[model samples]
Target chain A: MREILRLIVVLSLICGISAGALTVARLNLASRIEKQSDFYVRGPALERLFGKPAEELLGNKISLPIGDHLYPIFYLTEGSEITELAVEAPGPGGYGGDIIVMIGLDLRENRMVGMEIIQHSETPGVGSRVEKASFRKQWQGLPVDEPVELTSQGGQIDAISGATYSSKAVVNGTNHIIDLIRRHRDDIMAVIKAKGE
Target chain B: MTLKQALVHGLWEDLPPFRLVLGLCPALAVTSSAENGLGMGLAATFVLVFSNMFISVLRKVIPDKVRIGSFIVVIATLVVLVEMIMKAYFFPLSQQLGIFIPLIVVNCIILGRAEAFASRNPVLLSMADGLSVGIGFTISLAVLGSIREILGAGTWFGWQVFGASFEPFEFMVKAPGAFICLGIILGLMNAYSRMRGETFIQT
Candidate 1:
């Protein structure tokens, strides 16, 4: 009976202490982890979209709260004029996991400038073929308000053979970015305007 | 045991995966590149040292019946802590090591020391043992990683070690290569020990 009591006491104490330490560490490092993950995971994709490395592009990042989540938007400027904006978001309904994509919007031209696949866990050689430059070429200079869907549905995107779900993920991801832009236009302009001041 | 003896014991006598024949999962899984292997080693080393020290301090208070449970709590917490730190500061290396960092919680070496050595030892001595064993593991992993990286990828720590024309042995960086390389190294070490008239692999 004493042994059982002691075991309970010791194990509880150990677990309690451990939980405290872990909580502290997690709280302290949470933001930095988020930043680092973004810098590494989405950095390359942003670089590809913006025609500059993420190190430079992220320097002018402007964030706005869209619904419950704060969306970080990176912008490129030509001297004082903001030339374009880049944003990455996870598109739902992917075959495997959330298909993350970074897209650039040309502020002056009102067109979709460029796009790069930020992350995905889709099946290789088939579903993963969405990453190919040939397929990705479809997005360059597309009008920002273009309805992004597959060709069979009367949209421009042609689903890669044996990869409808993954291709749909990219299409959905692009539309998601467009919706974010349309919804947050006022908030985005306010932030950019505030920065200009 | 003296601090020096505790430290030295892990370097050669209980060297992991080689001498102790333990921690082969990470040894095999994350050793595709030198940087990856080194990152994993350092992460495990961090867990091992801290967990050993904490367990040693609490040795008497932890009842024997639930000691394993206590050890696990400490080990798992430290693993999570290390994972957070890695994600924050060593983000690239952390990404490369990936799931292996969290999996350090189940690594036998940390628990092995807690059960076999730290449980009976003084706190300082236990810490010394932890550092020594961790360093040995780091060295073993780094060496294995180097051999595989150089031959398999024709690079060492991502630096080209061969002329451009030199074709890399694609097989050397694959899963089967880890097994073959580990086997050959183990055999060679055993041969060396036999030649020196010493004991066979001792845990």
Candidate 2:
């Protein structure tokens, strides 16, 4: 009994100290990234392509309120134009889990600039192909005036070799973002304009 | 326990994954890349070592009836500390890890070790055990991550190993790949153990 008691005390102390040290390390890391990155986005890098700060323009904090979920937003100040919005969007319920992505939109051109997978929890050698630059580049310059559909749906984009589900998820997620942008187009423009004011 | 026992046990005999099968949550979650695996492993290691040491020291004072609750408190506190530090120091890695950092509080490995080992062992021995177990866990995650990264993305540790024409596997970076990879690794471990004339216990 005494031995058990001693063991507990020692473990608690060790946990306490280690946790404290980790907290310090994490804080340092965040600060460094903040110093380096021009802007932070809540969801995708689409806002960056537009030369606008997603976090600043969209106001997403560590946990920002999106339509329903909390998203982390970042921005690119240089590309804040109607034709360039780089934002990151997270596509949940992918083939494996969540597929995190960055989308670049050129509103002036009414098309996609590019797409990149920031992170994902997809299957290896199958679902993870969503991150491949080749797969992502397919979305570049895609007209946003119409719905972006996968080849399965007779769209311009081709589904990944073995990651049809994940590919579809990305298309769906991008389309959703486009819908949101269209719905809030004027509001977003106003916010962008007001920043200059 | 002796240092030799602590180290050896974690490497295989008492591995968090293959043997005890604890902390499978993050083990399967953040291991998409070698970087993530390393980050998660290091973070877990930090938590494991300290938690074991402290739990061993406080084993005497904590009440028996509330032992589980007390253990949780300690572990949660440690998790919070890790979360804050990761955010501050390793922002990119922390961002990659996302919510898994806080979720560490619920990791079975830490709690299991606290209950099974720290609750009965001496402080020094418990610390040794934690280090060994944490290292073993880290290695497992790294190996899994490397396999997934190499096959899925044609890259290892962000370096492109394959030729330009080599198409990367898309599914390997997803959650399903994690399970599949883990399953295969587990099977291999089972085979190796059996080959060595050891009893394979499925828990």
Candidate 3:
């Protein structure tokens, strides 16, 4: 009986101490970690879209709650007049797993300005080729209202000759970005208007 | 054992993944490049040294049966601390290392040292053991990473080491290449030990 008591007491004490230490460490590092992730991961992916380092884009980002994910919405501006929007979403049905796609949308033109694969685990040299400029270029200036699909699905985008799965994944990811934008258009615009002034 | 003995022990004797025959997962997975290997080794080193110290300190208080549980708690905390620190400061490397960083909690080096060495030894000696083993592991990873990076990409640490005519054997950077590289290193180390008439691998 005493042995059982000792075990429980000792285990809980250690766990409690561990929980305290981790809580303190997490609290201190959480914000800094978020910033660093943005700088290293999102910043590089969004470079072409911003035409500048994503460092300046930090001030314009707002956290938007959608479903279970809180996404950082970056509102791009030209001299304080909001010109475009940028976001990242998990595009499912990927060849390997969920492919995270970052998208930039031109509001005035109602077209996709840029798309970049932020993260993926697809087969290298094959599905990985979806990240190539030749493939990514197909998404640029694409109308957001239309359903983005592969040529086989009676749409315009051509799937890579041997990488049909990955090609389809990117098309779905592009459409996912458009779906989010259209669904949240009012809330996003309201926030933009409030921030613009 | 003397501090010098402990320090040198891990450096060459129990040299980890190679000689200690432990922690093969990270050694094989994250070591595609020198930078990644060095980063992972350092992160493990930090956890190892600190966990050894803490376990040694608490050895008396923790009961024998529940010791593994207590050790795991301590090790998990340290790993999370490492993950947080890496994400905050070494974001790019952390990103590159990805899931492996958190998996450091399961690394046997920390647990093995705690159970075998730290639990039976004093704090200072345990720390020394941890440091030496950590350093040795780091060096092994760096060497392996360098070899793979150089041959696989025709570059070392992202710097081109060969002329434009050099076409890299991309196979060296893939999964099969990892097994081959690790196997060759282990084989060579064994051969060297045999030549010296000494048993290099402790486990």
Candidate 4:
């Protein structure tokens, strides 16, 4: 029918025009948005975990190949010398959904400088307690080579009250990423060294 | 409708999520904090105003049978554009808002106005309707968000209002909390309307 044809043409034109406009907008703003998200959303967590300000650390960010994805690895320097490495690891095996954690490593001290929950979908009151300082602070200065586990499973970490599953997810996720880092420790160090030049 | 009538209607008489009883999903989901509410509201307002205006301008050209489809495409495009821009420019706010930004396409308030108001109304009146409805939605979300944040977390806009000793009622920030808070507010609004003897949803 003529009516059907007209309807199709009108809808197609509207959709085509919209898609075209969006593509233009995206092309112009993609880089700025990526920079902003890093500075705003992930910046606070990184700043808290690292003693230095986020803006100072921004210059040292480098992407390292880890598994199938390019993971962002930030170098914490002291007067041109790379003193520490902060790796943004995927801890996707969360109770609710994927959990991303930012972990700092002190290469000289050979310990975990700190860890922060960058993004998570855990239950607000229960599982979401992972955002608390008390819970996350336990990882500071922890020996990176040793297995990270909850006290219930014969490990050192204490689980949040009434949130054992979510707590376990964080512990397991950290351990999983830690194991990968340990396996590829030399390559990680090499990448950091190359970026420092 | 007159510009004055259109603007006034969105503010009180046909306030979305309350009097209009529309767009309750975002109202409940994002009102856990004042910041989230404000962010969602402003974003929605941007989409509503632009979408309404676009719909109004193209109303005559759009065939009646496929008007819904055209309206949806326009809205969907705007939502995508907003989502990309937010992710690129306002990363923190975008992250805080999460999936709610993309979900705006389905929000009844935007599409509702496009169909009921923009499709039939003149351009200026449609624009006025868009602005007023948006302001109404924003105010309602803000009130809900502030109350929830204050009671649930003892904070407003992430700043501590209560002293260190004050214990927060954790229940007020959860899903049940959203329902309870919105329900009470809706009841109060209904009571206020009863007192004024003004019927809501007057066409």
Each model's lDDT comes to 0.85, 0.75, 0.86, 0.85
Chain A TM-score, candidate 3?
Answer: 0.79
Model 4 TM-score, all chains together: 0.74
Top candidate by lDDT? 3
**Chain B structural similarity (TM-score) per candidate:** 0.97, 0.96, 0.97, 0.96
Writing each residue's lDDT as its tens digit, candidate 4 over A39-60 gives 8756776788786788888777
Across B1-203, the per-residue lDDT of candidate 1 in tens digits comes to 78889888888878897888889999988898988888888888888999999999999898887889888889999899888888799988876776688789889988999999999999999999999999999988999999999999999999999999999998989999999999999889888888887775642
Listed models, DockQ each = 0.64, 0.14, 0.63, 0.51
Deviation (Å) of B44 in candidate 3: 0.9
Superposed Cα deviation of residue B15, candidate 3 (Å):
1.1
Off by over 4 Å in 2: A1-197, B200-203
Candidate 1 local lDDT, A136-173, one digit each (tens): 88889998876688997889888888888888898888
Model 4 stretches astray by more than 4 angstroms: A1-9, A65-69, A78-81, A89-98, A108-114, A120-195, B60-69, B84-92, B146-203
Chain A of candidate 4 gets a TM-score of 0.79
Runs of candidate 1 exceeding 4 Å displacement: A1-12, A30-42, A53-55, A77-83, A92-100, A107-111, A117-176
| Cα deviation of B148, candidate 4, in Å | 4.7
In candidate 2, chain A reaches a TM of: 0.63
DockQ leader: 1
